[model samples]
Target: MFAGWVQERAGETPVRPRDGRLFVAGEGRQYVLLTYTLKKSAFSLGAQNAVLPLLAQASNAARASVPSAEVIQAGVVLHAAAAGQQASREVHTIGVGSMIGIILLTWLTFRTFKPIGLIVLAIAIGFLGALSVCWLLFGRIHLLTLVFGASLIGVAQDYGIYFLCNRLRADPQMDSAQLLRRLLPGLGFTLLAAVIGYMGLALTPFPGLRHMAVFSAPGLVFAWLTVVCWFPALIGAQTLKAGPIARGYKSLVARWPRLTNQPLTLVLVAVLGGVTVLGCSRLTVNDDIRSLQSSPPQLVRDQIKLSKLLDAPSPVQYYLVRGATSEEVLQREEALKRRLDPLIAQKHIAGYQALSNWVPSARTQAERLALIDARLLAKDGPLSMLAGEIGEDAGWAAVTAAHLRANAAPLELEAFMRTSASEPWRHLWLGKTEGVYASIVALRGMRYPSIPVLGQAAEGLSGVQWVDKVGGISSVLGRYRAYMGWVVLGAYVVVFPVLFPRYRGRTWRVLAPTAAASALTLALLGFTGHSLQLFHVLALMLLLGVGVDYGIFMQEEHERGSDAPWLAVGLSAASTILSFGLLGSSGTPALQAFGLTMLTGTALVWLGAPCFIVTKEEPNASPVLA
Candidate 1:
């Protein structure tokens, strides 16, 4: 009775039993079950919403030729209950712990009883500005954008310390206004360059990169303004005077001259360079999107469960199929599926979701309708009863004839349209072209080899073109690493040659130390079995920039016989090393990468300065002997 009702309402004939199962069929092909579900509770709404439309449309179009797809809404409530319990425990242990650590760091850095109050204010203002700018330009800030922007805590503190440090250095004879004038230009220039570097990332096509660029650029400016304009005004410069020397730091400075002139420093840096080179070669790029997520949330867990039950795997890789019409598109999709079948069988791929499995082309749909019509005609004994009173009436016959005439012109389905030529789905059989029309097939759990799978897949496809968009993150990071490496190298090459044109011959002296330091750091990482990733490469490049800056500063200071040069280098290195060194101790992988790179890079930069390389003009240039 249910089958009869479904066929009558759907304007199609039921070809099989009314059992609640997903079905797929084609002309001259038998119907097969794809998946099944059980009706249970309200939580099954996600599944119902996704599957109901396809089932209804298929049943209505196929008439009585295919069974209606069943709706299974069970199991979600139980899954949600379990997930909630797990989340509560994790929040208390991990989430609260991270919060406390962040708070403690903020307090120690600011060194004020009211540091928490000030930090809250700074965060509030910075977030407001970020949200306003993001909304105005991009409509929404992605979750990742907010997470990365929080890193401003580290970057912003640099500006704050610079301000406080300069304020403390100024002679007590000068007032606050004089102190401000002395520091503003240098601070402003540094902040401007930092802003420009971040803004450069916006040029990339990646959404995440764009978000980082937008949030960081403005946030840095705000931080600088806060430190220079607001922070000093609120906390007087007198409050920043160095306290009584700690025993550990005092002893280190007392031994500073001996440590600075040590011959073993060069040898140690050389050894580290060899190790870094080896580590660099072993580094792997992970493009997995899930790696960015902190952990799987409850929704993801439920989705995973549904995916397993429905035999519909979440796609780890996408296969894009394109054509001019629905039929052409489906044909291409089927062809790609055939090529992937072997990989699936070999367990190289878990499974795939393709449109060909759900929606057939216009030609195929028409052919199936023709077969159903022929079958109904062959059963003439029941046809009259099936047609009922409508078949005997002239008005009804005319209406049916007009309906058939309209459908004969080829039905236009929105699902078959493609947007662009470059996109997998470009061509459409109906309507004006707007966006590329393509179907994404999710690859099941497969251990994809490191080699290019898309190239091999493309080779098999021959005339049909296919592209993989999954590796976009790796590509972007790789390009950025390359660009930043060149930038750092160019900065050293150009700046040194221009500043010391006659001493350009000795450029390698300066570069050798920095290079050796970077190499040794990477070598240590590799020796420790830590594989360098994209972030590690980028961090190392930044370390090169910092190293070069220190090398230049130290070389210039040595030429002037400033007794305070060592002190400046020591303090500067201490500030950088302490901040970045702490970063290496972070639990987060990306933070640790940055920390390790900076820690090694700063130490090398300190040791690699051309102090010992005594130029021809100053052959007796020895701060130690003086």
Candidate 2:
């Protein structure tokens, strides 16, 4: 009776009997439900009614029909229940492990109680500042923003180390205020410049880069404040002395004068550059978003089960489509599906789900409803008898009115709608605020490309955009590569010339060390089979800034013939490298990139510093110099 009522209300035809089978109008396949007379199974009628609408919607939205619905029988419910439990267990495990790893790493890195407390406080302030700015600008912090902000540990530690190092090296007779006055200007200006460089990322078109820029920019200022203000006071009160400085650094710097002037050093720089260029050329950008999946165990297992059960492809691949109207959208999607059919058959694509298959058009729905009416309401039909003694014309009118009323409830017809109004579905739509509609057909389990391939099959369709396999980590990495190139070119154009405006001759000497350090870092990265990512590029830029500091320190130290400048350079480079080089051991790829760059760059800059030192005797030399 309920089925008959639903058929009447939905304007669906009653099932037709053919070869001892009943099939409803517009149904793609037929099914039978058999009930044995000897057995009476207990089930709640109210519960069944509660679930019927959801079942109906799923059936209507199903891309293919069940060949034999009775094949499930009763055990299907048990199997589904078991799968849900298994998925839940897996998710719990992965989430727990990930949390533990984050906490352990954080505790291990910030072991020094006093410095760690100050660093944590600074990070908190910086995070709040970043959160406020991101909230005001974008209205909410994206998931990527949190990840990028957490990764700022390597960059933020620089401030603390610089402050602590200066405090250790200060004359015991000098007060805390005097020590701060000496270090603050250099640390403050350098950090300000670094913040500017990071903030410049906001100019990029990519959302991830913009989020990173917003998060890191404010963090820099807060970190600087903690180091210059809070950190110095803490160190002064404690009367901290320099613990054993790395004696290896002094040995390393002792050879710098000879290494800088060597013919082999220039040759090594050129060779390193050549190697870097070749290796970098071979490196490809990976845009696969799946690379970021640190998915909880249960989600991964559930995904695997879903893929097996439905023979569905991975949702990693995406097809970008744009059109002016619903018809154009459907037509384009239909056209793309036809092109994709061969790929599907070849297992290039497992399966595609799209709105074009379900609705087709509003005109199509209206025509299907008309056909359903004729098929169900023939003379002496079960539905006709159920309509309660009405004349044929009156019965038809009553049925049509019911159908029209059902259709009027937009939410009821949601399954029939071309696009869903749900959040997950909204992600697939790329509509503008002005009502221009667009959709992406995501694909899964595509073959990984080792080399570039091009063609019509490769190029899905003309007039429609095809993102294909480019929207994940590879895309982010590619943007970073482009940004790095721009930074390198821009820094040379802007920074190098500004440093030595009066003397072009001196500029080459400064650039030589920076270039050597950059090349050596790139070569080290390449030799290790590590691709230079965005963080590496930023680190390279930072290496240039540090290289300038070293050059200035060495030049000044050599002129004064004092041990203090040498001590400062050694201690400063030591603190910078120790803080950053430790990051090379990080589990995260981004942090590793930062560490490797800093480690190689700092090592080379220290080696290259003495080349900038003036070795010739002064004309009017004091007896101290003589």
Distance (Å) between predicted and true CA of 166, model 1? 4.8
RMSD of 1: 11.4
> For model 2, how does the per-residue alpha-carbon lDDT over 553-609 read when each residue is reduced to its tens digit?
444334334444454565456545554555554434554566668778887776666
List model 1 lDDT by residue over 1-626, tens digit each: 44774454232212233566534343344454443354644234344455555655664656555455332322344344333343344334332343345445434433554434554455446656766787788876654455445544444444554444444445667766676675565455445435544565565566865887788777766766666667656656555434332223334433443223456865654565555677767655453433533323554664654444444433444655555555676677777777777776777666555555445566666786677456543333234444565446444444554565466554344533332322222211222234444555555464547226533664656235544445665666667666765655555554455435423444454455566677767666766766555556656555554454444433433443432334344444655565566556554456567667778777866765534344334645344321
Q: Which portions of model 2 show Cα errors greater than 4 Å?
A: 1-189, 205-219, 222-243, 246-255, 259-301, 313-415, 418-480, 501-512, 545-547, 615-626
The lDDT per prediction is 0.52, 0.55
Clashes of each: 22, 9
Give every collision pair in model 2: 90-298, 91-298, 286-474, 287-472, 287-474, 287-475, 289-472, 314-444, 317-443
